[model samples]
Target: MQLNPEKDTELSQKVNRETARLPWSELMRHFASGNVVWIADELDLVDVAVRIAHDDKASVGQWMAAGQIAKVSDAQARDWLETDTSLWACVVSPFILVQQQKIRH
Candidate 1:
């Protein structure tokens, strides 16, 4: 199957539109959610937003509405984790562990 250049471009534009609308605060909230998968996905989202915002603050809702970014799902989160096991150990898994430790004390 051949790629349709117009459709691809349109699709990308739509994605951009959706992503750009996500506001920065909401983005951070998503990052803070208890679900490791949600945090992992939002981490990727924030990485992109930080790059785009450069020095400016952007919102999650803005990015969502702008369609510039695609939200990550649980399956995608698993792929990300599988690709970097250390990431899971150091990031997603440990945060909960650390918080739990603190709570236990």
Candidate 2:
């Protein structure tokens, strides 16, 4: 299937705009419902959200296999609660993809 670069770009920009920094506390309900996916810090949270939105199965599968992305675990949720971690989050329906906010110098 052919991809439209313009459409893809627009989607990426839209997702990027929707991404925000949120405290873990604010996401507890979603976590409890198992609708939160943890993104590796090395990955771009917005890019992951866009891929999921586009239904890029191959890329999503690879990330899942590599453990770069997965549902938030109980242990992780507890840790985040303890530390009050702030995350970069973007929603792609059924799931909210999140990553540790990058520390800016």
Candidate 3:
């Protein structure tokens, strides 16, 4: 899911706004990290966020604001992904399921 450059910039801003300490690049990298991948499986959130960032950064901001993704500090997000596999999967799975449903529909 390739996002337009403009949207990517905006989404990055939005994600940053919600997770103050987690920069967009860092977040993406974190999502892609081996630990996160092993614990949480695929990174659908990062993929979608990347796509959304390319198109509508504001919407990404809205998602972060809506508390769909646990808006924790960078340390906490990292810790959660590291220590809480079930919780991390719970948060990430819904987005992937929703996206799958959208594609199916």
Candidate 4:
């Protein structure tokens, strides 16, 4: 399938506009349904969402292999719940990709 750059850019913008900072508690149900993916702070949440939306398996697989992304684990969930963490999240269909909010200082 040929990828249209213009379409991809538009999709990225849409995903960026849809992204938000959501409380972990609010996302518990999605996590429970095993539909939450934790994205590392080192990566751009919107970029990840765009890649997932495009089904760019090679990029996603490389990120996963490098420990830059993964299914939210029980331990991480517990930590987030305990801390009342708010994460930057973007939905890519069946999955909600989240990243820890970057610290300014």
Candidates' lDDT values, in order? 0.34, 0.87, 0.38, 0.89
Ranking 1 against 2 by TM-score, winner:
2
In the range 1-105, model 3's lDDT, one tens digit per residue, is 344677666754554333222223344444544222221123344444444434456665555566543333457456645753233221232121111111100
Q: Give the TM-score of candidate 3.
A: 0.27
Model 2 residue 68 lDDT? 93
Candidate 4: pairs in clash: none
Clash pairs, candidate 2, are: none
| Cα RMSD of predicted structure 1 | 16.4
Give the runs in model 2 whose Cα sits over 4 Å from its true position. Answer: 102-105
TM-score of each: 0.25, 0.92, 0.27, 0.92
Question: How far off is residue 36 in model 2, in Å?
Answer: 0.1
**Clash pairs detected, candidate 3:** 7-53, 7-54, 7-55, 8-53, 8-54, 10-57, 11-57
The residue-by-residue lDDT of candidate 2 on 1-105, one tens digit each, is 356889888988898888889999999999999999998987777778778888889989999999998999999999999999998888899998889963222
lDDT for each residue of candidate 1 in 1-105, tens digit (9 for 90 to 100):
344667655644443443322222233334456433222233343233233333223444454456533444456445544554222211222221111011100
